[model samples]
Target: MPRWEPDARTRLEKAALELFAERGYDGTTVADIAERAGLMKRSFFRYFPDKREALFGGTPLLVGHLEQYVTEAPPGIRPWPLLVDALTGTARFFPEDRETARTRHRVVTANPELREREVLKTATLDDLLRDLLTARGTPPRQAAYLVRLALTMYEQAFTHWLTPADPEPDFTECVATAVGDLERVLGEWGDGG
Candidate 1:
């Protein structure tokens, strides 16, 4: 075994996803993932504290991205546009390759534990977003409502972006489409439909 290997983190992530998909999340062990990545168990710990974290290693970075975007947004920007900008800015954190994303989504959704983890991670994000907005002078109630809308927009955009027939839809464009759909819905209510 080499004393040092570059990109060990990426290698381990790919290995873990492959194993999780193949052997199922519970069936796959930390040792199995490390070995598949051509690393040792110790190396796995160096990257992720546990097996479940391998699928969520990017959570902190994602949280930080939102934090930075919200904090640095232009002074005159309203909460809704800020929310949209913050959410769309996260496009870089996700995989450009749709299949890799689909596989990870599959692995997470297929397991109850993983699904719970996903929910917890999402809640953490939503809470932070609301807090960030409130900190930036948005009313607490409005911040909370914006967070909920952002969550819906993100989910809708991601699902549409992951569609198999799209053949390379841009995540940002998908988000714009969701925003448009939301506007259309709100417009209907305004017209007393």
Candidate 2:
């Protein structure tokens, strides 16, 4: 048997992602992942409820950072900027393991079930953002719109940041560029009116 190691959670995640990439998400099993990580099946269950959860288990961390950032932002900060700050703040939770991220992205994108789970996770974050904004005195409708726009920009920026040609290694730069793009688009739209 392979020697036991520390950082069981990280090891399991890396192993699972690799197996998912090799065998496809549906074809991979908990035992396969655990075995690859040199762990027992029960050890895998301790870290993740299922194979899908292994990929998405960090959602709570991301949501928590966003909530904290939004709630603690300077009182006078505008809604859009607050949203940008909150979104960017959550980027730090992503691991710097680019290849693992790429493989996990491929697996999640390829599976319909995984895609649905991803959408659900995004919606949860959207709801959290909306609630945070509303508690800070924004109207419900405006909060909803702001949350959607911010999430859209975040998604675009994250995708751009992950691209091979993206020169910047930091995720925040991509987010800043996305925010600028959003501002330019809105400016053009307002001018056309």
TM-score of 1: 0.95
In candidate 1, which residue ranges exceed 4 Å CA deviation? Answer: 190-192
Best by TM-score: 1
The true-versus-predicted C-alpha distance at residue 60 of model 2, in Å, is 1.4
lDDT of 2 by residue, 26-134 (tens): 8999999998988989888887888888888789898779888988988899898899887887767877776667777889999998999999999999999999999
lDDT (Cα, tens digit) per residue for candidate 1, span 84-188:
888888889888677899999999999999999999998999999999989989999989988998899998998988788736679888999999999999899
- Give candidate 2's total backbone clashes: 0
Displacement of residue 159 (Cα, Å) in model 1 is 0.8
* TM-scores for the candidates: 0.95, 0.92
Error of 1 at 107 (Å): 0.5
Those runs of model 2 whose alpha carbons end farther than 4 Å from true positions after fitting are 1-5
Whole-model lDDT per candidate: 0.91, 0.87
